[model samples]
Target: MNTETFINQNWHDANQQYLSAALAVVRGALESYTTSLPHPPELTAQAAARQQAVQQAAAAMPAPSALENLCRLFELSGFERDLLLLCAGMELNGDFARLCAIAQGDAQKAYPTLSLALAALAYPHWDAIAPNAALRRWRLIQVGEAHTLTLSPLRLDERILHYLVGIQYLDERLAGIIEPVPQLGELVPSHAALAQKVTAVWNQTKTTTLPIVQLCGNESSSKRAIASQICQIQKMHLWVMPAQVIPLLPSELDNLIRLWTRETILSKSALIIDCDELDINDAARLNAIAHFIERTNGYIFINSRERMRLPQRLLVSFDIQQPTAKEQSAVWQAALSDIAPQLNGQVKILVEQFNLSPATIHAACAEAAGQLAQSQNNNLTDILWDACRIQARPRLDELAQWIEPVANWEDLVLPETQKQILRDIAAHVRQRSTVYNTWGFAGKSARGLGISALFAGASGTGKTLAAEVLANQLRLDLYRIDLSSVVSKYIGETEKNLRRVFDAAEQGGVILLFDEADALFGKRSEVKDARDRYANIEVSYLLQRMESYPGLALLTTNLKSAIDTAFLRRIRFVVQFPFPDAAQRAEIWRRIFPPNTPIADLDVVKLARLNVAGGNIRNIALNAAFLAADAGEAVQMKHVLRAAQTEYSKLEKPLTEAEIGNWS
Candidate 1:
């Protein structure tokens, strides 16, 4: 047998011997007290010999028995230990109840009680049954209701009874509140190193003064994996408790701390309090978390996006990140091992585009494999890319508006200079891995590597259109960041909101378009008041995050001069989407209607003379099509003229004779 099996068998044999010997003593006491007969001297000597034999056998076992472990862990005294055994005998051996009634000299008192233990058990003390003693404090035995403390009927707790017999499990009181973290496969090299470092920090310290190992980062899976790996190395169980579940009521919170502390001792376990999704603005919940951590002691890990402050204890933090690009590429190759030969260097493209954890990469590969199985001839590149995009979508959906990129380069009407800049933006995103990694740009410095652009023009110009075109060319998701939702009136709230957006977008296969940037990116005001200073701080924070962001961040503003000069200096590209002149407007009018739409007598040159931007021109053409359909005729000059009037009125401008003369 293995060591565990051997130890368990020895414990069982020793426990049976101990219980039998104790019961013989109880029977002897009953016989001498009830029958008015002399207790035999040899009987007493035989009980003592049996007790000594069981103690020697227990000492010879490889591991301590369950009863011994409990006594040692709880620091139970001699009286408390025997008192627990006396109550357990009533359940384990049915005859002990009748003997208890006989020994007490009353038929009604058939259960073990404090009064019976004081009179029957050897070396008993009155304080053994006190509320603060080991038996009552650790809840090893339950005392039933009675008129007096000494008369209360005592019974061994059901959990404790099972535990004494070598059966172990988590306490039922912690069933829903605490759950085990699932063990994952082998970690990447970097993450494995982190796990080792954490193990070293914990192993170097004593159990009572162990520092709280806080894993801080946006990659929650990596944090959890490291924690679980460390526990496995340390030979302990790891459970997760959400920060929100820390109770607000003091009584309930104290109960939870006591139960959890006891469980850690019993199961040799660690705890990971997950605070990754918690809102830092919630002061009440944060305070409760502090209280819970301060009260409980054991192997504790906190998973959060930022390091939490706790002044009362020592805390060590490790920033957990996703695997490196090379490691991720290796993971992708391994995940697609069956068909990796057919990829033709496409794995490199995946690693360069999407920053994913190993777990996510495996999931994406599995999903792609499922799709490839359903159809034999599907493009493997598209299938794999789509799977990755779907996996990274759920979190970003709650943060920004996902704009489907349908506009192509042919649709946008910018000048050649601005158009080239937009194309350059796409090229930067595509070749970033080559320039930064292979060419050693990343070795120099980490700053100014992000691809950020500024699109300054009027409202109706094609700034948003340019962002869509780039997203389409690059095959990435485009999200429009609504400034109203991001900016806050409260101090420091804007930075928190922005941090969440960037952190959620860290996977790097998406575009962030901040529309109407002048609102938040305006010039920093002079510090005449505290509000002014804080406002400047918010502006500086935005600039810092934008510069450090991995993916593309595009900002559009109507007033170029209104934006802070510092922001302009940090941006890599600035494309001016000036108001479309008549030539560009004519081009927009030419391609406004699809070939499927019926049209007649549409004078393009005359329509271009309306002196409006490309956006207004498209609006007029669409409205004209609607009017012609309603009148059951092809779109003509009269339809276009009427739509132009309506468009001009919406713009709050008058259509003079010079702009649309002789349209008919």
Candidate 2:
């Protein structure tokens, strides 16, 4: 209820009782200091009585019961437990003068002497008198042998150190504080549960050490958060792997590890290897690090993308994903609790669109609230979009594609043969994953086996539209890979950029449309010099990647002749997007607008006479609708004719008398 009450309950009576008794003895010692001491108290019986009285005064108070528990649990020597109690109690002891004398200890000799502690009423081991002695493991009790022996008050730790410290003069303030190290989420649920299981296993087997718990996930924050939770649950001090904070140089990490190991063993804490950076590329390195984490009672947690294989010699591992939707809902609710009015629907949207880790959810929610304060809004949807964008922004920018799919294959009016070929290409792309691997198409290697299609038609023969239709059908993200970004003037940079795109998108399994392929996929000029040879090399590399890629890759070139014949030979599909005929133009007009658009009986037959391609047909209809809407009139035949006139002017083509006949 109150800080004092909490402190008293957590600290217990050991430290208090130890301090009181110690002070009482020291008080008696100073009173008797002018008399017979440990020497011959028999001859001077009165002086002997005074010395004995002080000893008896200290002995009258018993050690705190907590000390007995620590000794029993840790199997500590009776002397060490008593030594801790004496240290705790002596703090409150009114014997500063006598204790100071003991510390000065005939110091014509070593002033910072451990003998004072040993010489007190209790028996102490000479070996344990050293500063680094294992006897001081109860981290609360810090004794330093510097210019003079100094006793630091004990500090409480949630870690194993606290358990060992018991009721000594542990600092209450110290125990309550956390260093506030940054964390993602607490230990993932499965990891915490697994840790409990491991602890039980350790108990059953009496194993003295713990192995790293390897987890796989997209974000490292969740892994680290899970790890921190584990240490808290186990009452262990948690530290993220020191390698992160240490420099990258060879010896730097090693030195950090040494410092880390010493501090952990001294503090009796565990380590969590938050390997959020683990991926296919770093599998070997992940395994190597996990190898080293297996040697300590200080546990290590490895969170990675996939299962890593390491010698099972003493290691134990479990996998964890970001919490389920239900769990995420709870996390969202908890994180957004402060802004419930604003977050009511925004949380749901985030849950639907993003599979975020608990840490990410909290961060996003907090950020959303902060932004809302700046924007002065009670609604959180705006903040939600910002968070979503931040999460999605890491996937590199090839060109972003927009797919407004209003028409399907049936709406397209290509020639019968071209239509059939287009349908076949769609089918091939649809069944690619199953057919390619099952049919042993990608068996020889991942090299040069992807499905590459070339769309060779006039500028607007539905090439881009077809790419969108297929992408929508496959339910995959479509990226129009900017060739300018992919092609490099520098030697070999072209291939390097291409590899980055392919490698990053390997998991997303996106469809890449390399628009205007003629710029790069040109006929190889004769090997006139090294530049020409490099140009040929670039073409060869593209061909291999297109074939080897395990996804659909489409290259659209307006001029098929510009693409090398050799490149065409390796392409699995090449569909020509022919110029639109009268019939095709009519079909494009019929489907140009949605049924909801208000039209004043515009005839698709009359509109088709303009002889524009599908792309231009859609553009003209859009312009015409805006013009009609602004005039507060329905879109009629006159609107279509005027839009067409403007569209033809832009194309640098004149509307023929036969095409525009009887338009008004």
Q: How accurate is candidate 2 locally (lDDT)?
A: 0.62
lDDT tens per residue, model 2, 209-253: 554566555556655666566566667666554323323444544
Using lDDT, give the best candidate's number.
1
Provide C-alpha RMSD values for all models, in order: 3.5, 11.1
- Model 1: which ten-residue window has the lowest total lDDT? 26-35
Can you give the lDDT of residue 201 in candidate 1?
A: 96
Q: What lDDT does candidate 2 reach at residue 194?
A: 62
Badly placed stretches (over 4 Å) of model 1 are: 1-62, 86-111, 153-155, 339-342, 593-612, 616-650, 654-664
Residue 176, model 2: Cα distance from true site in angstroms: 19
Q: Each model's TM-score? A: 0.89, 0.53
Number of colliding residue pairs in each model:
0, 21
Ten residues in sequence with the least summed lDDT for candidate 2: 169-178
